[model samples]
Target: MSFERLNQINDYRQLGNTNLYVSPFCLGTMSFGTDWGWGADRAESYRMFSLYVERGGNFIDTANHYTNGTSETFLGEFIGNLRDRLIVGTHYSVFTQRGDANSSEDRLRKMVQSLETSLRRLRTDYIDIYWIHHWVFGTPIEDVMRVLDQVVRSGKILYVGVSNTPAWKIAQGNAIAQLRGWSPFIGVQVEYNLINRMAERDIIPMANDLQMGFVATSPLAGGILTGKYNQLALARQISVSEMLARIDCTTARASLNQEIGRLNLHNLAISLELMEIARQIDRSPAQVALNWLLQQSDITSTILGARTSQQLEENLGSVEFQLDMTQIADVDAINPTDSGMLYGDTVYSEVQDILLESARVVDLNH
Candidate 1:
């Protein structure tokens, strides 16, 4: 599709009055290289990156630890001088070594230096957004925020976000920053999808209360919701000997649960339903899933990874169309929220009925 054909998808919202404009979907570069076991090569990665930019996508997400830095390397090469057009986010503090000690204050500085190395690899002078990849045991939150503030002040990173940090810790860190008159985190990155709604337990409500931007990663549950796998059919079709030769326990189970559970819930087959939905909407299932996320309130973006240009293209169609209430509720029924918690006050009060009273339906109209 041509760039002109692509909608601008201006689903922008203020991140606590930060004056930052962002789309509701962010392109994830985790599959830029094969270091994490499966990904595209340099050529394919470039193609996907170009396609994403051509589709009016400005935000890009990656990690220093993804593909042993190859993801950043590809992004660096791909972005070139057009870096100003990109709101790139990369992370640190993930478990790099099984037995090594976690990052300390100095270690966090080293990590930021390593991020500079990533900047070199990315061929950019500064990162648009930087993330605390995860909370390690040794680094204090105060120390981490101090470094983040320093980097932001130095113009090394335009915005800072935290990933996988607890709600209370984020609250405390922001409170400290507020008290000290320092820059607090403007965004949060976390695993949020139909299956992994765990962040809704605390993170979503906290972000809502603080007016922080929330970017959801792993929205597909690692391809489970794509309706691409068929464990039952594969098991039935393959002979015992052939199955033994080629069967994968992990992939098969992942496929089976998504397929069977979807069928059981919908009273229809998974692939058929997905294909039907795609046919009716002239979109791919990946697009539908991404649109489901993009339609939610308080969401800044949904990060996506594509090993091929085709996958990226299919996923980008999500921006072209949207899901209505009936469609969203169908998917939501398959993946219900943990509606038991009261979000704003962090109380365990039942607020579903009251909240639903004001719940607006998602659609093209609004």
Candidate 2:
């Protein structure tokens, strides 16, 4: 479909089974401040925020530890009067105060303290969605679920989500919540992109079976799928020897070189194929990559981050067009998910045939 025929940013979707409606693209505020020396400044951050809100984007994501709390502070100012109209989501379990024993735990005390601090920094009364940034080993799953449920009951949070967690843990925690009459996780956030199909092995399937929303982060694979690094390597004509020599000099350059080196032949092939598809469609590689994630089933929304207004604008254009089935299939063919040991094509087909006993299996969506 043409850009002109694409859906507007305001075409919202229900977050899981909740009553809340949010934009297809979530505005990630990780780069809201330059405390990390690589983020956008306050002025540029506000500009990006204004532009996104003006374009009908209503979902904003932040974390307590992001930019050392500057992200939440900046968002507090940008969202002054519009808080009632937007869905604000923030995470905890990663940030902590010095000398506070319970600060880093997922227990009741830490969750409460963290939410209070986040609320103060965000200049809001209640959070729309609260997430446990990551699983804390040794912490009881029941404790986490119960505290989250308590917060939801107290109106401190409207919904709960989990990020950077395993699929089996998510399933176990949610099942416990259901049995105990506590709040279940309505959404999941994970690293998903063209280069990383790990989530497809379990997370995506789990979310589908549980009827939960899947929020994808790093859909650009840390900018690898953008094809910029490939262009740089080609333009500079840097040989392997020269690349190795430079890696021993500057730390930043060495890091970049390492990241580029980590991109195996499969990754490079996907990047090249994505660029070719973008060229044929007259769109940026980043846009094509984001659109590809958005087109997947069970993907409720993808979080987008930018260091400048220009980058944000380019990313917002991802929803301007839809990839045809052929284009999508071609992309999928290059990065097919790895079927597990018991679920290979032959084994799965035989199992299905024996189970169905000559009955035709129909795909509902088709």
The prediction achieving the highest TM-score against the true structure is 2
Question: Per-residue CA lDDT of candidate 1, range 1-366, in tens?
Answer: 001122345555555447766666688998889766678888899998888787677888888878889999899888878777778878863543333333321256566766687688788888877887655434566777787788889898887788766788788889988888777888888777765676777887888888898888877666656755434345478533353344454543344444434223232244335546666877766677777777777566778877789887777777777677777777665656676643323311222222222332234444
How good is model 2 by TM-score?
0.85
Local distance difference test scores for all models: 0.68, 0.79
Cα RMSD (angstroms) for every candidate in the order listed: 10.8, 10.6
Model 1 regions more than 4 Å off: 1-16, 96-106, 231-283, 339-366
Scored against the true structure, residue 316 in model 1 reaches a CA lDDT of 74
lDDT of 2 at 157: 91
Clashes by residue pair, model 1: 24-301, 76-122
lDDT of 1 at 275: 45
Residue-pair clashes per candidate? 2, 0
**Model 2, span 1-366: residue lDDT tens:** 112223567888788878888887899999999887678899999999999999999999999888999999999999999999999999985633454444554647777878998999999999999997766543578888988898999998999999877788899999999999999999999878877777777888888889888899878876768877566556779743343454343433236436445444556668878888899989999998888777775678889988789989999998778888788777777677776632122232443333333334355556
TM-score of each: 0.78, 0.85
